[model samples]
Target: MTRLPTPAPEGDPRDGGRRLMLVEALAGRWGWSPRADGDLGKTVWAECAL
Candidate 1:
């Protein structure tokens, strides 16, 4: 029988960095909604949620 490679553990700093980069790329390409008070983190989170 064939076996698949084991997946890497989650929440590693490297993984976090990769996730952040992915989020940034998505935000840049699609653009985020405007925030009521110009909160960047909130905007990023809102975009990421979508």
Candidate 2:
């Protein structure tokens, strides 16, 4: 059997606006909590409610 590796996501714009857009989309659609800024001192989390 053989498997193929996933393709990398398209590159974001150098200004990083596109990267943040992608993150927000995924978090919103998946019910995932966005990452915290280090100053928040919170644990990483993922959650969804059925």
Candidate 3:
């Protein structure tokens, strides 16, 4: 059986920022619709598939 790496915990500061940066980078790369706040909010409310 193959096992996947576990996702980062929600409360870790470094992991939290890293995930947000990745999301913003992907969004910029693909030209997706921007968030209503004009930026990726500190807390992501949804999971977007790249």
Candidate 4:
């Protein structure tokens, strides 16, 4: 599993939304699986399978 770091611009709602959109795009393009760990909202990670 590979980790893709998606750091959203702090204190910006639009950038956060864009980050979410990016995650969705990646998931659609490469079929990445997103799983939330116990710590939510602090990190966004997409697992890549080769």
Among all candidates shown, the one with the greatest TM-score: 4
RMSD of 3: 12.4
lDDT of 3 at 48: 54
Instruction: Order the candidates by lDDT, highest first.
Output: 4, 3, 1, 2
Off by over 4 Å in 2: 1-14, 28-50
Taking all chains together, each candidate's TM-score versus the true structure is: 0.27, 0.25, 0.27, 0.32
Worst 10 residues of 2 by lDDT: 40-49
Q: Give the TM-score (vs. native) of candidate 2.
A: 0.25
Kindly indicate the candidate among 1 and 4 with the higher TM-score: 4
Candidate 2: deviation at residue 47, Å? 7.5
Clashing pairs in 4: none
**2 versus 4: better lDDT goes to:** 4
lDDT string, candidate 4, 1-50, tens digits: 66654546667675354566566666634332345664434444565445
lDDT of 1 by residue, 1-50 (tens): 52322224465554323454555566634333346686633233524446
**Model 2 Cα lDDT, one tens digit per residue, 1-50:** 42322223568334433444444445533222333664522232333334
lDDT for model 4: 0.52
lDDT of 2: 0.37
Q: Which ten residues in a row are the worst by lDDT in model 1?
A: 1-10
